[model samples]
Target: MDALTSVTGDGQHIEPRTEFAPLAVMALTGGEPAGGQMVSFFVDDPEGTGTDFHGGSPVRVTTASDGTGTTDVPLLAGEAPGTVEVKVIADGAHTSFSLTVNGHPEGNSGA
Candidate 1:
C-alpha cells in the first residue's frame, strides 16, 4: 500500500505499479540501455505462516527474457494480501522499487 520508486544509476526515476492476485508475488528484475549486470532479485515471506504480507519467503524471480527488464514472480500458495519485502540486488547499478500484490495500478484483475 506504500508508494514505491525506481531510481537509475545517475539518479534517474521510473515509478511503476503492479497488481496482486491468486498468483501474486512481488516481481523483481530490471534492464538498462547499457551497463549493469550480476544482479539478483528476491522476495521473502518471513512469517512462513501463509501470512506475513511483507515478503520473507525469499522467492527468486528471473528476467522475462535474457536482457529484458521484467520478471515474473508467482506468489506463495494461499498467500493472503498484506505487506511483503522485496529486495533487489542489481550490482548497485540501478535502483529498485516495490511492486505491490493486490495493488493493480491499471485496475485490471489478472483473473
Candidate 2:
C-alpha cells in the first residue's frame, strides 16, 4: 500500500490566509500494518505569535498501517498571530518546516 497524508479543518472558521507546511518525508519498507510502523507529524509555534499551536505543545500527525493519516491539528485561538513548524517522523527518520499564521476574526464563517 502507498502512504497518504492530508490536512483538514474542523467546523471551526478558518482564515483564507491560513497556510500549511510540507509533510515530513519517509520511506516505507515493511509490507503492511503487521510489520509496518506508524509515522508522526508535528506542528509547533516558533515565533510565539499566540496562535494555538504556539503556546501549547506541538500538534502531532500520525499514520497508521492503513497508509492513511490525518493532520487535523489546531493552532492558537486569539488574534495574536504566530508562526508554525511542521515536522514528520517515520521509521526513525524525520523532517520539519515553519509557516506564518495570518490574522482573522472569529465567527460562523460559511466555511
Candidate 3:
C-alpha cells in the first residue's frame, strides 16, 4: 500500500516569531522507502500575518536516496501564539502535522 509517514517536526512547539524545526516526511510503498519522490508540504496560516512556512506553502521537496524528503526551509511563527497544521502529500497518500507556537496568554491568537 502507498502511504506517507511523518519523519520529524510533528507535534512540536516553537516560540513566537521564531524558527521551527524543518518538517520531514517519507514516502513508503509496500512498506519500503520510496526515493526520488516529489513531496508537497502545505502550511496553514495560524494567525493572520503571523506564522508561515519559510519559503511559503506547498513547498515541494524531492526525496533523497534514503527516501526521506525534508523541507529545506524552516517554519516561522508570528508574534502571536497558536497551532498550525502542515500537510504532506505524495504518491496519492497524505499526512499532516501540528505545530504550536507556545507562549503567554494561552489562546491569545492575533487576527
Candidate number achieving the greatest lDDT relative to the actual structure: 3
TM-score of 2: 0.45
Can you write out model 1's per-residue Cα lDDT over 12-69, one digit (the tens) per residue?
1222232333222122334223222333545554533243223543333333323333
Model 2 residue 21 CA deviation (Å) reads: 12
| lDDT of each candidate versus the true structure | 0.34, 0.46, 0.83
Q: Write the per-residue lDDT of candidate 2 for residues 55-110, one digit (tens) a residue.
A: 34454545555454544554544344555555656666555544555555566398
In lDDT terms, how accurate is model 3? 0.83
Tens-place lDDT digits, model 3, residues 26-95 = 8887888889899999887656537777767878999987789999977788877778888888879999
Error of 1 at 111 (Å): 31
Candidate numbers, best TM-score first, in rank order? 3, 2, 1
lDDT of 2 at 19: 33
Indicate which candidate wins on TM-score. Answer: 3
Off by over 4 Å in 1: 1-32, 46-68, 72-78, 99-111
Sort the predicted structures by lDDT, highest score first: 3, 2, 1
